[model samples]
Target: MGQGADHLTSNQAQVLDHLRAANAPMTAYQLLGRMQNDRGAVAPPTVYRALKALEEAGLIRRIETLRAWAPVATVRPGVVVICDDCGTVRGVEAPGLLESLHERLVAEGFAEARKTIEVHGRCGDCAEDRA
Candidate 1:
């Protein structure tokens, strides 16, 4: 379990483990399927609840555009770079960038703004392949 995840339920920890092992984002249903395949007959609600808890605890992030979830790779503010071609999602840490972004938002009168920025582009390997 992660530092903050010491209080997670068993199911939530399992979900977090699966997400950490995954190379890309996974939808809730997909997680359920994996669990069911491994352990048999896990309910959809069970997985959904676990996901909710994990997300709330900052152990995971939801990719709104893809409707998928990814493990939080760091404690910094969430930023994900999605590979449009291969569907790879990689977390990135940019505290300075996040601070500037929040500053800009505050300047525009957006109060207490929290952000999860998703940038879509080809990844290095994919770009090299294309080249």
Candidate 2:
């Protein structure tokens, strides 16, 4: 699906590259700082625009609660799990059952329905640390 990235603008490509290489979600300001450090003096609006374009292209997902973005690693629906203590973000590919549910929703006259399911909890490592 990200095959369309071949046409991405330079800034958009930069943003996507950073997200793809990141181990966790990143906020726009973080991306801007990285870009600025590497390329010298990047504008906040530039980073934001690139992020918007990448999101619209379905190449990234926003962790709404964290106000952060993560690269899409698969074509399947994603269930984002976030750690409250360490701020770790992980994406789980949901079962095909969700596709059927979405289809049912569309059939029930909810044509514009969109959902992003997020689960928040402490990760195993964090839990172990606490114990």
Best by TM-score: 1
Give each model's clash number: 0, 0
lDDT of each: 0.82, 0.82
Model 1 lDDT per residue over 1-131, tens place: 35466588889878888888888888999999888887878998999999988888878888988999988773235678899998888778787887897888889998864676888989899989989
Per-residue lDDT over 1-131 for candidate 2, one digit per residue giving the tens place of the 0 to 100 score? 45446589999988988988887788999999999988888899999999888888878878888889888773235588888888768877777857887888889888745687888999899999989
lDDT assessment of candidate 2? 0.82
Q: Candidate 2: which pairs clash? A: none
Error of 1 at 81 (Å): 0.5
Residue 104 error, candidate 2, Å: 6.1
Model 1: lowest-lDDT 10 consecutive positions? 71-80
Task: Evaluate residue 50 in candidate 1 and report its C-alpha lDDT on the 0 to 100 scale.
Answer: 96
